[model samples]
Target: MLLNCDLGESFGAWKMGLDEQVMPHIDLANVACGFHAGDPDVLAHTLSLVKQHQVTLGAHPSYPDKQGFGRRSMQMSEQSLTNTLHYQIAALEGMANVQQLSVSYVKPHGALYNDMMNNPQLLKWVLQAVARYSRSLKVMILATAEQDKHRELAHKIGIDLMFEAFADRLYTDEGLLTPRSQPNSVHNKQALLQQVSQFHDDNSVTTNTGKRLPLVADTLCVHGDNEASIMLIQDIKQLLNT
Candidate 1:
């Protein structure tokens, strides 16, 4: 399993994740674009760290909601949403190009990511945006235990989709991630290790309801905002390697 983290989320004076320490431990870095919490300087610095660590770079795009931190959902037309996605991704890709690095994957941030998974129309537009950027750029989405509508749409769109499982997020009874607003949405260290161990054993995640939800995924994500997650990321790496 490939370990990944959201990076470059820090805005001007406000620093977010510990990209310096976290980049060295993960296989993929989902660098945030300017829309959510990243500025030009932050993106450049983050890219440098990613390049130094030789980690794979991915575009982390979100709605044009910086104040909300891209966590709140918005009502948007399909064309507008498509344009927003393309623009944010292109911004990151453009920066990466100048630095002699290329973005290999695309992952939507917060609400946009959640919207795409549940709304087929929105997912199509997002996929369309991805195809517009690069046919080969793989889009990352949450992996479900059972049926994944997003996967089917991505296959039809002809762009590769990479399924992702979270180490810190809580899962619902239906194998979907519980809404972050709910209590216990974030996992404790013990629960996290248990989930990772299960995935490391086979590609399955134990849901909150105590069911072994089968999750076939390509990458594992740990939010970089948590300072304690650095240790969790290391522990997960150790578990996976062992």
Candidate 2:
């Protein structure tokens, strides 16, 4: 399976993630647009890294919430949501164009992603935005129990879908990610590697309640917000390679 990470989250002097260090280890870089964390320079530098590492780029868009880090849900009218998505995707595509690179997909960030998964109308808007932007760009989403349902919707919207499983996040018995607000929502180093192994070896993951849930995923996602997570990312890469 291909590995992906949320990179380019660092904003101005307030840095976040070791993007320069972790870029080489990932297959896809979900580089954040300004709304969540990244600034113009950060986006440009990240695109350069993607080119340097020969990694695919994907636009990581979110609600216009730098304060909550795009983790807090926000309500928006359909037109406004559409405009918001288009604005973010266009920003990344424009910068990528300068480097002779292109974004292959769009992954809604944090609350926008979780909200889209749980709300059909919101997802339709998201798909429509991506479809309008460029049908060539796929929408990356969580791999859950309702794969067929998601696929059917995306098909109707005339956009492709890429389902990704989190390597460092806890899963529920239903195959959805454990809410981050919960205790132990994220895995430790050993647990993270074990989860990646399970995804590689079994096409499944052990949920928070210790139940094995089958997952058909197109890609695996790992975090790299700190030095420790960066080491865990290297271990995950090695584990997946094995």
Candidate 3:
């Protein structure tokens, strides 16, 4: 499976993630928009690094919650949410255009991503924004028990969909991501490897409840913000290679 990671989170003065060390290992780069943790300079630098490594570029739009690092969900009107999504993608497009690069896919970040999976109304708004921006933008979505629900909706909207499986997070028996605030939200190296190992053999994940949940993965995600992310990615590459 192709590997992906969130990058471009380092804002001015404050720093986060092992982007430089991890970029070479990832196949997709989800660059953060300014509303979250990236500035124009950081975005430019991140896009450049990902391009240098020949990784596919993807835009990561989030709820306008930089202070909460986009992890906090917001209740917004349909119009406002649609506009916010369009705004973030356009911002990344503007920077990418300058570098002779173009984003090929879209992935919501933090609460926005979680909301898309849980709230169908919010997902429709997000998809509307993506289609309005460009029908060609493929959308990245989490692969869960409700995978067919997304496929049906995305098919109806005529937007291409890519399913992603998490490499470092715990899953619930229902195939939903366990809340990050809960314990064992992020897996240790051995746990992470054990989870991904199933992806190759059966396209499945071992849930926190010890159930095997089937999933289809177009790409595998590793969180760059974790202290163990670099090492985790290294093992992921090694495992995939084997």
**Superior candidate under TM-score, 1 versus 2:** 2
Q: Could you give candidate 1's per-residue lDDT for residues 119-198 as a string of tens digits?
A: 76787888877887754799988887544666677778888888898887788866678887789998889988988888
Window of ten residues with lowest summed lDDT in model 3: 223-232
Model 1: runs farther than 4 Å from truth? 146-148
Model 3 segments beyond 4 Å from truth?
A: none
Model 1 TM-score, all chains together: 0.95
Q: Estimate each model's TM-score.
A: 0.95, 0.96, 0.95
Instruction: Provide backbone clash counts, one per model.
Output: 0, 0, 0
Candidate 3 — which pairs collide?
Answer: none
The model with the greatest lDDT is: 2
Considering TM-score, where higher is better, how would the candidates rank from best to worst?
A: 2, 3, 1
RMSD of each: 1.5, 1.3, 1.4
Q: Candidate 2 versus the native: TM-score?
A: 0.96
Candidate 3, residue 241: Cα displacement in angstroms equals 2.0
Q: How many steric clashes does model 2 contain?
A: 0
| Position 169, candidate 3: lDDT | 86
